[model samples]
Target: MNPPVFKPRLSTSYLIVDDHALVREGIVRVVTNTWPHAHLSHAASLHEANKLLAEPGASFDTVVLDLNLGDSDGIQTLKTLRAAAPMARVAVVSANNDLDLALACLHEGACAFIPKMGSIDHFVRGLQTLASGGTYFPRDLLAQAQQREGAPTGVQPVAAISLTPRQHEVLHLLLQGLTNTLIAQELGISAETVKLHVSAILRSYGVANRVQLLLVCAGQDDSTAPQTH
Candidate 1:
């Protein structure tokens, strides 16, 4: 024999947690279309989800959760489910279009963030992306987020795209070596929101990480820097 061939794992099991029966049906439709042989399970509350997870041999390859469950806290539910089934890829299907919340879900171990208002095609794409082990954030969501950042304020960059005002604040604080949590506390925003801003900042600067950003900003004059709050 020349060699042994390795096959990719096919995702055949899924768990959907949402209080609304209609929403669960819609997601199940998407799943059926995408993976016709997939075994689907539904839970309306965190309690039900935990009960299912506690089953001795019951496990799903993927989990799609709602952020606003009838009996669960916001992102805490996602965190709990993630902790319970560490092997399953979690995706947040929420009505909340807040980019901050979406990013927060990702930070909390969700592999994908899908807004409920998206088209059927969008849902199919998101599910496929997650099942294939790639992180998915809708292209339109990223575009909308960047557009909402608006024009840059305070420090102007030599590069084409300037930093947004919030991003400028985040960058300045970051230059001071403030951690994300501290920056969130100082700015009166959630740490998840700060992470989104920081990610945008890094993208705008074309830097791989904070150290590179610091090196790029090292040459800039301090006179034009905005005063920290």
Candidate 2:
């Protein structure tokens, strides 16, 4: 039998926040192809993006944002946007593919980090993952992150850390980069319950947040980590 097709929960609405018109145009083409009926809004600066995000009843399934906006630069742009649209998945597309910056973006709740240097297909696959409530992070970058942190490359066994069975399930999804909301939907649990399990998992690993937990569980299978395509 064929595998079941994944369906997105939200209607396809996107906010593309980038300072470059050319980049925005390219992304628009990719998104249009992915979701033919997708509603797209463009912002050339952080200020313009915030205005659109703050509009009453504004809801976007995803925000494809550039870290180096004209009004804001670096991770602060992500922080500000996260506050403005807490419900939207924010994907960072940047010229810099630095592993540390990518991890920082994840720590700040970005659903994906796509380096501008990557191919169009990579970006398209990322959009598809986000649409299905999954996150996309480049695998090579993640390996580099583990290397820099003095951890072995690829997923390591977590048998050393004792956790409840449910916490183990939560940890698996967490390593996959699923947000609490998505994890709740996958596990058929409340978001609050997912949050509690995540907190407990953090304590069990003696880590503070999702990013740290990921580092602690660096032995996890790479397939379980965020996808690149």
Candidate 3:
């Protein structure tokens, strides 16, 4: 039998705050897929987000925030938003995958901590968990953090990097040595979009090309060398 489809909660609303247009667009696309009818809003900075949230009858079920906003400190921004909208859940989407920062956000009332390079599965799972009034941290990250503090180990843990659902799909195909054109056809996205995702994935993995990226993902550490196009 096929897996059940994910139905976003009825009338669920979201606020996405990020400085980069492409990153914002990626998040928007992911959220739109899961919550096709959700009331989605965007802001580029803390000031802009505050202004929108201040409007009368302006409310959101969740706010997806970027930790490194241009004009605000990360935790301070979380505190400010929490003060202004005490009932809304906050999810921090950031490039900083530091475990301490993730823990700090949780302490300050964030419902989820999603790294920008995390796979689409983790992102969607985080959203689903938060929408149901629960907390979320990437399982691998959480496990590593726990291990550092003397928790017993389970399976060997892999480091986490963020990737949107579509990007994850592209990366999986790319690992199989597929070209952008082939990946585009496989995923039903434009080749241009596949290129964008590949570049973003490269940046996230700190590699210069597909070969190095595949190497890094295979538990190797060759990314420290100079990149080649």
Maximum-TM-score candidate: 2
Give the CA lDDT, 0 to 100, for residue 17 in model 1. 94
Tens-digit lDDT string for candidate 3 (115-206): 87768776776665544434456766756555443333332222346556566566655654456886788778999999998998777776
TM-score of each: 0.59, 0.69, 0.57
User: Which of candidates 1 and 2 reaches a greater TM-score?
Assistant: 2
Candidate 2 displacement at residue 155 in angstroms: 4.3
Residue-by-residue lDDT tens digits, candidate 2, 146-178: 556544433334444556656766765675456
Error of 1 at 84 (Å): 1.1
Off by over 4 Å in 2: 1-11, 148-192, 199-209, 212-229
Once fitted onto the true fold, the runs of candidate 3 whose alpha carbons sit more than 4 angstroms away are 1-11, 118-121, 128-134, 147-229
lDDT of 1 by residue, 77-157 (tens): 887887787667678888887877865675565656788886878777777755543445666655443344431223345
lDDT of 2 at 10: 45
Displacement of residue 89 (Cα, Å) in model 2 is 0.7
Q: Show how many residue pairs clash in every candidate, following the order shown.
A: 0, 4, 7
Task: State in Å the error of residue 53, model 3.
Answer: 0.8
Per-candidate alpha-carbon RMSD to the true structure: 13.6, 6.4, 16.9
Give me the candidate number with maximum lDDT: 2
What's the best-to-worst order under TM-score? 2, 1, 3
Model 3, 23: alpha-carbon shift in Å?
1.3
